[model samples]
Target: MYAMPNNDLEEATPWLDSGEQQVWRRWLVATAQLYRYLDEGLRPHGIDLAEYDVLVHLSEAEDHRLRMGELAGQVHLSRSRLTHTVSRMESQGVVLRRTASHDRRGVVAVLTDEGMALIESVAAHHVRAVRRAFIDAIGRKDLMVIDRSMAAVIAATDPASGPPDH
Candidate 1:
């Protein structure tokens, strides 16, 4: 594996240089702003970005359903967190949870017709918000670079890959 060079002030400790620090800070700010923008855009539809993400995943799954654990991973939520969110969505008539038919011990999250309708209603607006806040703002070439960069980050941090040797 290729390793990044240690460019710390001292040989024993690694630290980000000024340029790297600026990049890190900007990434943090941009991520926060983009999420807020998207969430706010969905507010009028009575769903936040997280809920919208869940609904999208469920809607695209077979029979509009997924095992709870699988859904949690897809939506980047913890099992406990997904449980709470699913409960709330259930109460709102957007989702339903039932024991998995094949595995009695497993739970599944299913999108209701209401959930599908809700996502269909907001998808266009959400796309516009995404374009306005991120895609258009970054331009096509930069967006491509960002996509590749994010994929690299995800690969490097994948749990199955274990820790880096360094």
Candidate 2:
């Protein structure tokens, strides 16, 4: 239980009410737990959640390639972080970076055959993990509600509908 702050209009800005606080707290906890659970499930395959996300995005790209900047946005990673992650993946023969054909100044990350193979190998297990941890836990009805709710949040936050961070 929380004591409501005295509404001294001149003294403080608006703050979350008890109901809003409860929702926010639960959102944070659920996200953290979901990521941890997925990461752990991928550990046996030698990839963390973020890395898996990178591969998944690359796999869906045209010719399995995307500009460095584009890939960063797709994976919700900072430019420098994507560079470092791609560098490591390059050394592992999973991906390679090259100058973009359309823009010499732009770098493009291309998924290698090895990377494709790796993703294929882990796809089934990953799907199962996702189902076990999230989909199955939330039945279809609830999942649909969550989907629409999340879309609303995104639209409200991003009125322009510009490129997303993820």
Candidate 3:
């Protein structure tokens, strides 16, 4: 059997050079700032980005409901994390968790009427914020490139091709 070398860790280093590092650092900063801006925009609606994502996903789901496991996977949250979040939202009348009729072992999370109303009321503001921070800032030509690049990133990070969730 071959033995591992002392320099094994060095082989794991990113391939980025100095210029790539500069570009990557800028991208990281921009990503954080953008998230902060969006979170700030959601403050008035009493929702943060993660909760908003849950709301949006549920709202778009069939009958505004999904299995807890499905919801967690769709929202990219851990099962325990989704349970905690759903519990809080349930207390706020934003959503409800119920036992599945067909499967005793399954739990379903459904957006409540009040939750639907809240999201509907706040959606316009969220859309406007997105437009202001992103769409409005980028030129149409650049936006196309950005869109394509984002799609490529998503494709690359998809479960089948990429490493497990980071």
Candidate 4:
């Protein structure tokens, strides 16, 4: 259990009650375990969660392509990291990098036919994993609660939402 700070200077700041602390700890562990579970499900395809994320974004983009910076942000990878991952995927014939037509200096990531086929084959497995780890565990009645809670979190903290980070 987390103890509330006793310092007079810090006392004004509210600390989590025991119930809140328990919930907070469980949320952290649950998210971590869920991430591991999903990644494990993707292991057979030789791609981790990050690579799978890139493929999913590219698959949904117009013409199966996105500017490198845009894709990096979407996949929550640093530009250099995304570049490295894309390099590995390129070697596997799963993706290709090209100069953006609209901007000579901008790089674009495109999904290859092989990448499409892979996602098509692996998507059902991913969906089932998601259901088993999250949706079914939460059940239909609580889905909206989670949706609203996460939306509030995003609105408060997401840079794209224009909210100042605490």
| Model 1 stretches astray by more than 4 angstroms | 1-11, 164-166
Taking all chains together, the TM-score of candidate 1 against the true structure is 0.91
RMSD of each: 4.5, 3.8, 4.9, 1.9
Sort the candidates on lDDT, descending order: 4, 1, 2, 3
State TM-scores per candidate.
0.91, 0.87, 0.85, 0.91
Better of 2 and 4 by lDDT: 4
Candidate 1 per-residue C-alpha lDDT over 79-131 given as tens digits, one digit per residue, 9 for 90 to 100: 99989999999999999999999999999999999999999999999999888
User: In candidate 4, what are the lDDT values of residues 1-166, reduced to their tens digit?
Assistant: 4465688856776678889989899999999999999999999998889899999999999999999999999999999999999999999899999999999999999999999998999999999999988999999989999999999987778777785633
Candidate 2 regions off by >4 Å? Answer: 1-14, 159-166
Which of the numbered candidates is closest to the native, going by highest lDDT? 4
Give the Cα lDDT of each candidate. Answer: 0.91, 0.89, 0.88, 0.92
Kindly list the per-residue Cα lDDT of model 2 for residues 60-162, writing each as its tens digit.
9999999999899889899999888999888889899999998899999999999999999999999998998899999999999999999899787783877
lDDT of 3: 0.88
Summing lDDT over every window of 10 consecutive residues in candidate 1, give the lowest-scoring window.
Answer: 1-10
> What ordering of candidates by TM-score runs from best to worst?
4, 1, 2, 3
Best by TM-score: 4
Backbone clashes for every candidate come to 0, 0, 0, 0
**Positional deviation of 136 in candidate 2, in angstroms?**
0.9
